[model samples]
Target: MLNFKQPQLRDVIEAPADIAQVRTNLARLYQQKRQLLTDKAHWAHNDAALFEAGASYTRLFMDKMWEAFNEDKLIGDSALIEHLWLQVVQQEHGTAVNVNYADEAGENHVLFAIDQALHVQAHLTAHELPVLADITDEAPDYLINEKMFPALLQIIKLLYAADLRFRSPKETILQPVNDLHFGVKFPDAKTFTATLKVSNNVAVPVKINVEIGHYDVRSFQVVDETGNDVTTIGKPHVSASGTFSWEAQHLPELTNQTLTLTVEAVAIDTLPCLDNLFVIASGNNILMRTGEQVGSFQLELPNKQELGITVNSQDETLTLHYPDADTQIYELAKTYSFFGEWLEATLKTAIIV
Candidate 1:
């Protein structure tokens, strides 16, 4: 832990510490935010930088926290940091972060205490009130409403309904989800990027196909770091759903070249625009997000073969299952929507260097 002090708005901008220090300060601010609750002051808009500063700090903090959590640095209770945030702000769940809306009476309102923290921070930092406890910068804690709540529900319903309505007779093939899952050995691996070891016990030389299909691609280009298109078929042949396809064969025995696809979302000002992005290679499937790369899955396929898996992002937690796998319930990001500004993916064949 680093020595952290409550910062004035100027201190946050001018005397910036390393990000760890910033995180410490931000945590301290959260601990001290209870004072704001009692003051009941209206917000001031002048100290918007407070939001920006806090947002930057919180972003770094969350990243570090996630990294540590993923690496098992936190002994028993890995979710301590996340729990602490929810506890301090009195939120029931993580998604209960700062959310704003007007009440039925048409009065500006917030749905979470995190919002209250931002409100008080703005008011006190603008010098509207004497410094009340450490001014909390809750802007970073606020949840981004990438799309309206109902709109997201519709996407989920459409996908789920599509699965139910379009099931194939014998295999129960979910139209889109099954279309996303077919031909992959491990349909249940939950991850964004991974290297799958192909069993040397197999007889045939390993081969796999990678296909990404989406709607509303703002921009789509697959290339190398030097801006060269490394696709084998000249350029990836795209179909109706903005599909990009690639095939790799005889891996682990030869180090094949790599290819990448950079994608951007088409601008859609219309409300409730339903956009989609999905990638499948080997047995892995992942829903691509804006500014995210669906690449970097490096697997070695030699005499047998290796498969790299980039699993789908259905929600916060991933549950693995076969094609026949079914669950009574599932958890997914309530706010997640495929509509984003850009996406990218890279593919590499497994070969002994």
Candidate 2:
């Protein structure tokens, strides 16, 4: 394992290391990000970086979202807009409605503008405690009603009165969440008491694992609240022993608040690099002998015994192999299309060396 105390990085800008090579990986990413950001005016703002991987938005809207989240920047500016309707709506209602509303565009095509607005609002509230604060950031009465609240309420009232008055959120095509199941669930609680229920359709008992998305509750003491874990709450224990369930309880000792729970499942399901990853092990990096041009490659580790390679991990040329083998990065045709940003050149099972 690579172990070192944090060193103060001053003049040394770029360097490479083998495992956990922080500088190398970040430098490469910086280069790639710079290349993408320089040409497009869309990703001018910080928040638009999320879209560069694969997003479809004009440069103006991306800038708007970033402004809302910046610490020094408060909720102002009307330049950012994804949909024309939102621009019109804000223009009409902004001043009258106490809308200091900085707008944002999010992940959807239509009503998602509302979602983006709400998301930005939620983010703003959570970060600044805007509700309790004075009228410095937003207008006082704007909090009286939201952009969609009045409309949704009107629709609800119409539905209750048996009147087909207002359209209900534009009919949406939803994916059926039937066959796919969250086989196991972990309950976040203090004292870490009770067993959580596991849901699955399989007749035979399959080893299921528990997940609390995006929170590390390892530091929480016994019988303490798992507040930071934004997942399902205290649940009944599963019948099977060794199965885990969690709960929230008061712990007066600890200062930094978090949750802790035990999860029981087979270790086989613990393969971290399975999805979108094929291998993780040591290997002698290789080179391809293609007729057209040469590229670098690595014999990436699948495990202790086997090694396979792709372009994602390391994208340098194999200078050691030289004339003997011209390296080319290859991938599966059915799964991947290209390496890095080359749009047309699809991946193949074997490198055409």
- Candidate 1: residue 344 lDDT (0-100): 11
Which candidate leads in lDDT?
1
Q: Tens digits of per-residue lDDT for model 2 on 185-302? A: 1223223232223323334222223443322223221222544542343442333322333443322333343334444222211222222122211112322221211111333222
Q: Write one digit per residue (lDDT tens) for candidate 1, span 66-107.
A: 343334333123322222221122222111122234433554
- In order of listing, the candidates' clash counts read 15, 18
- Model 2 TM-score is 0.15
Q: Which stretches of candidate 1 lie over 4 Å from their true place?
A: 1-10, 13-24, 28-97, 103-309, 312-353
**In model 2, which regions exceed 4 Å deviation?**
1-263, 268-272, 275-353
By summed lDDT, the worst window of 10 consecutive residues in model 2 runs over: 169-178
lDDT for position 85 in model 1? 28
